[model samples]
Target chain A: MVPLSWYLALSAVLFTLGAVGVFLKRNIISMLLCLELMLNAANLAFIAFSSFFGQVEGQLFVFLVMTVAAAEAGVGLAIVIAVFRNRETLDVDESNLLKL
Target chain B: MTFEQILFILFAGIVVGGAASVLLQRNPLYSAFSLITTFVGLACLYVTLKAQFLGVVQIVVYAGAIMMLFVFVIMLLNIRDEDTAVDPNRFLVYLTIPLGAILLGALLYVVTKVNLAQPTGDEGGTVERIGTNLLTKYLLPFEATSVLILMAVVGALHLAKREKE
Candidate 1:
C-alpha cells in the first residue's frame, strides 16, 4: 500500500496551492474555482484517513461535503452572473462598490 | 517502486499539475477545464484508496454536474480573458507566499506525527453499506442536506432572475 502520509502531504500541497490561487487570481470565478480546489483537497484527506482506518464516517462526510459544494456552486455562480450583469467585468478588483 | 506507489505518483502529478494550470490560466473557462482534470485525478486516487463509491460520485457529481454548471455560466456571461487589473493591495500577494508556506509546513509536521493503525480490511465504502448508514446512523444530516439543496435552488433562482422592466 502507498503510505498514507504521502496522501496527506499531497493534500497539504493542494490546499496551499488553492490558498495562493485565491489570493493571486483577480477574477471572482477563478477565486471560486480555487475554493473548489481547497474543498477537494480536504476531501482527499478525509478519504485517506477513512481508508486507513476503515471507517465509513469519513466517506459519509465526504458525501455531505460534495452536497455542500454543489449547493455552493449553484448559489455562487448565480451571484457571479448577477455581478457580471451589473458590472460587465469579471475582475474582483473592479467590483469594489462595497470597498471604501 | 510498487505498482500502487507508481499509480499514486501518476494521479498525484495530474492533480497538482491541473491545480497549477487553474492558477496560471488567464481565462476562467480554461480554469474550469483544469479543475475538472484535478477532480478526475482525485477520483482515481479515491478508487485506489478503496472508496470506489466515492470515486464514482466524485466524477459524476463534481467533474460532470458541477463543471457543466460552471461552463454554462461562463458561456452565458460571455466572459473574456481577464485583463490585468491594477491591484489596490499588492502587499496581500507577497503576504500569501509566506502564509501558504507556513501552512504547508505546519500541516506536514502534523501529518508525520500521526501513527495510525493498519487498514482494518473492512470495506466501509460500498454503496449498500453507505446507503444503509445514511438511512440509519446519518438520517438527520441526510434529511437536512435535502432541505439545504432546496434552499440553494430557490436562492439561485431568486438571485439570477432578471427584474421586470
Candidate 2:
C-alpha cells in the first residue's frame, strides 16, 4: 500500500503547479483550469486525511467541495464569456482597465 | 513495491505530467485536453483512496459536464491558437521557481513529520455510510448545495445570454 505521505507529496506538487500556472498564464481559461487543478489537489488531501483517520465527514466534505466546484466552474466560464464579449481579449494584462 | 503502490505512482505521474502540460501548453485547447486527462487521473486516485463516490462525481461532473462547458465557451468565443497570451513580467516568471522550491520544502517538512494512526478499514468510504451521513448528518449542506447549484444555473444564463442594448 502507498503511504499517506506520498499522496500528500503529490497533492502538494499538483497544487504548486496550479499556482504557477495561475501566475504565468495570461489566458483566463487556462488560469481557471489551473484553479480546478488546485481544487482537485485539495480534494485529494481531504480524501487522504479522511482515509488516514477513518472518518466519513471528510468524504462528505469532498462531496460538498465537488458541488461547489461545479458551481464555480459554471459561473467562472460565464464570467469569462462575458468578459470576452466586452474586452475582445482574454489576456489578464490587457483586461485591466480600473488600475488606479 | 506492491501493486497498489505501483498504481498510485503511475496515476500520480499521470496527474503531475498532465498538470504540467496544462500549464506549459501554448494553446488553450491543448490545455483543456490536458486538464481532462488530469481530471481522469485525479478521479482514479480518489477511487484508489476508497472514495468511490468522489471518484464517480469527479468523472461525471468534472470530466464530463464542466469540461464540456469549458469547451463550449472556448468554441463560442472562437479562441484560436494565436489568441494565447502569456504573462510578460519577467520577475513573476522568475518568482515561480523559488515559490515552487519553498512550497516543496514546506510540503516535505510537513509530510515527513505528520503521523497518523492506522485506519480501522473502509468504514468511511462505503456508499451506505456515505448516504446515511448525507441524509442524517450532512443534510443541511446537501440541501444548500442544491440551492447553490440552482443559483449557478440562473447566474450563468443571466451572464452568458445576449444583453440587449
lDDT of 1 by residue, B1-165 (tens): 999999999999999999999998888889999999999999999999989999999999999999999999987877665343326567888888799889989999998887776466587589998999999999999999999999999999999999889
- Provide DockQ values for all models, in the order shown: 0.73, 0.77
Name the 10 consecutive residues with the lowest summed lDDT in model 2 chain B: B81-90
**Model 2: runs farther than 4 Å from truth?**
B80-82, B88-90
Model 2 agreement with the true structure over A1-100: per-residue lDDT tens digits: 7888888889889898999888888789989999999998999999999988888788899889988988999999999998999988887777777987
lDDT values for all models: 0.91, 0.87
Model 1 bad stretches (over 4 Å): B82-89
Backbone clashes, candidate 2: 0
Instruction: Tell me the tens digit of each residue's lDDT in model 2 across B20-55.
Output: 999989887789889999999998998888888788
RMSD of each: 1.6, 1.5
For each candidate, what TM-score against the reference?
Answer: 0.96, 0.95
Q: For each of the candidates, what fraction of the native contacts does it recover?
A: 0.75, 0.79
